[model samples]
Target: MAGPIVSRVSRVSGANGSSAAPIFVDVDTGVDDAMALAYLLASDDARIVGIASTAGNVPVDQVCANNLGLLALCGADVPVSRGSDRPLAAPLRTAEDTHGPEGLGYARLPSRDGTLTDYDAATAWVKAARDHPGELIGLVTGPLTNLALAMRIEPALPRLLRRLVVMGGAFDYRGNTTPVAEWNISVDPESGSEVFTVWSAAWGLDRPTHLPIVLGLNLTENIAMTPTILSRLAAAAGSATTPMSVLDDRGSRSAASNPLIRVLEDAMRFYFEFHFDQGEGYLAHLHDPLAAAVALDPDLVRYEQATIDVELTGTLTRGMTVADWRGHWGRQPNAHIGVGVDPEVFFDRFIARVGPYAATLG
Candidate 1:
């Protein structure tokens, strides 16, 4: 259901400065995505105006369900809409085993049949940009399918958006889904290509200012989900399990002891168990949240300008993010590439931001 539009900037800028922009999030609800949503809701620097779900960590249907469930858990009022069923080019591939059957680490959600905006997801995205013209920040935490659709439907998308921040591709690190291509781009390289070509050409903004796709594996993998963070998450799991409890359990309980811990315990234990079985132990990569973090704070990452294009035809290299970082091709760089992150400080800030949200998960 829609919540009162209490001035997007005021709601997000709570205690931080009052210059935060309104955010439009497109997601595929994995556990990390759930955490990101909670973090954004908690932050004073972001106002999540809307959410569009796509096919990625799980099927489109399940992702939508997860999105609504997570928003409801936060007691948020943002609109949730269904997006593209498949990528703009290739067939859709979902990470069922990784996200579990429900795409939320099998976190049980309530029967919250909330109403969404009447507009289609693509139309809603363009409208959000148009209504606020150059004031909206597009935060894409999943594949670029819905965004490609928006560009196709609204030919003036370049003029509508202030900035488009995406989570995909790879420059130096090994890919999570393949050796060369990251999971989001590999799912639909054509969409990634379309976004890069259209936004870069249509905006006429400075070379590195038009469209920025935050490469996942390269910048985020190092921001591991450490045990200390998991323990903090475990302590905060009560927020995800209140529907099962009566009023006796409502408000002002000792946070150190949470009922939601049972679910977090199961999810994290399962997550670590699977990774450990593969010999990686408790360490799991930070794939999507770090991308959202870039949108929230660009300084967390060190960027280098580059010309980027996706390989759509190569049997072996298809879906790879072919970046021209050294200007060998003699063309203007289309986008900025994120090459490095302050590992210690990045994780430290991430832990500080997400620790409270993880506590809410229980």
Candidate 2:
């Protein structure tokens, strides 16, 4: 592929000025996934340790291509890996409508060399947990198929990681792809069920923080994507695209600007168009990015530890998250339920963080 398009946006140094970014991401290369990846790669704190591609937003092959394309756009040097070709038990499905035919909207994609590391998505998960042991953060922004497969192969999958942050399941909110089923879980309920049961088991670490799954539900759905946020993102990208930008305190504006702004603009535009075409009242939601944000800064949301289950048998409730909010069932708290988020604070930080990096996109 040709070199990435350059920009002049200021890149956000690592969140705490730490040298190493410690996140491991698994994606299906959805536009939303690409945005979350952009945030991670652009940030100085959240380094890209590796990438594992799965079949969700697109076929396994296309997902790999999309991953490379986005990585190239961000000028990321992280290693890439190909994950599971099929779901755990059910027939595989893809979100062609939401993610487009390429899983990344209409953006031109990079050619694949079939050279990605051949790690099973689940095996990669197991190994990530083992390598980082009690300190690794595993962020899942796609269907739970790869994760389910990993647990099946290792059985102790949940115990392998420090955290398993997911952007799936709906509770106390309506679904996006179906009346009751969220797109990710509904795409593969069997895998979803397997994940719930495996993670629910208290066989590994003594601390409850060891394997708490962050449910999306009401947490991210209604969070609007405002015009102000869009404009800021676009401007950040525009500044990057322009020439003669000076290096600032954040980083080298000329060096990191192009990648940052282009990424932010690509993400914001795709998000804006999707919602606008659907007449979603001229705003979009940061569904996947919220998951990433929560991982980077949990203060963005107010969470409660609870026993959550994915309902698979109900005709109108399949893929729904049944959160034990009140402890009425007396079940052990298996995961963390994000019941509420501070919208204003989240939006402020999100824009502030993304805006500077976007300046590089131009």
Q: Which candidate achieves the best lDDT against the true structure?
A: 1
Q: List where candidate 2 sits over 4 angstroms from the true fold.
A: 1-21, 110-114, 203-205, 237-270, 358-362
lDDT of 2 by residue, 1-362 (tens): 22212111112234355555467788888877877886776576566677788788788888888887766655567667788777766677887766667766545544543367766666777777676655566788888888777777777666655566788888767788788778777777777777877877745346565545565757887577665665555555555233211121211122224454544444444555667667775456777777877666655666666667777788777667776766677666667767777777766666676767655544
How close to the true structure is residue 90 of candidate 1, measured as C-alpha lDDT?
74
| Top candidate when judged by TM-score against the true structure | 1
Q: Give candidates' CA RMSD values in order.
A: 8.7, 10.0
Q: How close to the true structure is residue 89 of candidate 2, measured as C-alpha lDDT? A: 64
Using Cα atoms with residue i matched to residue i, what is each candidate's TM-score against the true structure? 0.83, 0.82
- Model 1 poorest 10 in a row by lDDT: 3-12
* Residue 221 displacement (Å), model 2: 1.9
Q: Write the per-residue lDDT of candidate 1 for residues 1-362, one digit (tens) a residue.
A: 22111111111222234466688888888766765676677566777888888788888878888877666655678898888788886788988666667876535666556766677678778877877776677888788888889999887887666666787888866676788998888998998899888877775555345546455577776777655665645434433332221222212222234433443333444454445556665556666677677667666777666778888998888889887766676666667667677767766565566556555544
Cα-lDDT of candidate 1: 0.68
Q: Clashes in candidate 2: how many?
A: 22
